[model samples]
Target: MKRIIAKQEHCMGCGLCEVGCAVQHSKSKDPIKAYNHEYPKPISRIRLELNKPVSFAIQCRHCENAPCVVACLTGAMTRDEETGFVKHNPEKCMGCWTCIMVCPYGAIKADVSGKIVAKCDACTELSVPVCVASCPNGALECKEVTS
Candidate 1:
C-alpha cells in the first residue's frame, strides 16, 4: 500500500500539512474557514515533531494489524479492504478515546469539538492528500510501499 513519508531534512515547520489536513476533512474545503471551525485546536492528526536531529510530520501508518482498529469499542476505526487505509466513521465513534490510547504513533487526535477521533485517511477521494499537495518544501510525499 502507498503511504505518506516525510523527509525531515526538507521540512520547514511551515505547518502546511496540518492546514491541508483540516481543510481536506472540513465541509467547507477551505483552509481559512476550516482553521476557524473544524481545525483540531491543539493537536493535529498529522503533527510536526521537532528534535535535535529531526523534525517531521507524523501520521497513521495504516498498519496491517492496526491496534487502533482493534481498540475502537464502537468499531469507529476500520481498515479499507482494498487500499489498506485506516478510515474512521464519526457516527460510530463514542468519544471513548480507546483508539487514541492504542495508537503507537500517537497519530490519532480528537476532533476540534472533542467529539471524535481523527487520523489520516490518505485523502482517498483525491490522488494525494491535501497535505502533500500544499507542502511547499517537498518535505511530504505519498508513494506506494511495495511488499
Candidate 2:
C-alpha cells in the first residue's frame, strides 16, 4: 500500500498541507473560496500538530486493521480491500463518533456540524495526495509499504 509518512524534523509548520487539502476537497477547489466562501467551510483531512520547536503533519495511516472500521456500528467506516485504504461513508454515518474513539492515531475529525467523521481518504482522486505534494520542506512523502 502507498502511504504518507511525515518527517517531523523537516516540518516548518507552514500549514500549506492543510490549505491544499481543503482546496482539493472544496467545491470550488480554490484556496480563497474554500476558506472564505464555502458554506460550513472546507475541512482539511490532514492536521498540523505544533509544540513550539516541534511540529508535524498528521492524517490517517489507512491501517491494515483499522479499528474505526470495526467500531463503526453503522458500517460507515470501511477498508478498501484493493487499495488498503480506510474509507468513510458519510451518507451512512450516524454521527456516532465510535470511529473517532477507536482511531489509534487520533486522525479522525468531526465535520463543521459534528454530524459525521472526517479523515484522510489519501485523496484517491489525485495521483498524489495534496498534503504530501504541498509540504514545503520535504517533510511529507508517499511511499509503498507492506500492509
Local distance difference test values of all predictions, in order: 0.83, 0.90
Q: How many backbone clashes can be found in candidate 1?
A: 1
lDDT by residue (tens digit), candidate 1, 1-147: 888889999988888888778777777777667667654543347888887467888889898899999988988899997888989999899899988998999889887778887788788889878789889999999998884
User: Which TM-score value belongs to model 2?
Assistant: 0.95
Cα lDDT tens digits, model 2, 1-147, are 898999999999999999998888889998988899889898898999999799999999898888999999998899999889999998999898888888888999997668988889898888988999999889999989886
Query: For each candidate, what TM-score against the reference?
Result: 0.88, 0.95
Best candidate (score: TM-score): 2
lDDT of 2 at 122: 94
Q: After superposition, how far is residue 86 of candidate 1 from its true place, in Å?
A: 1.0
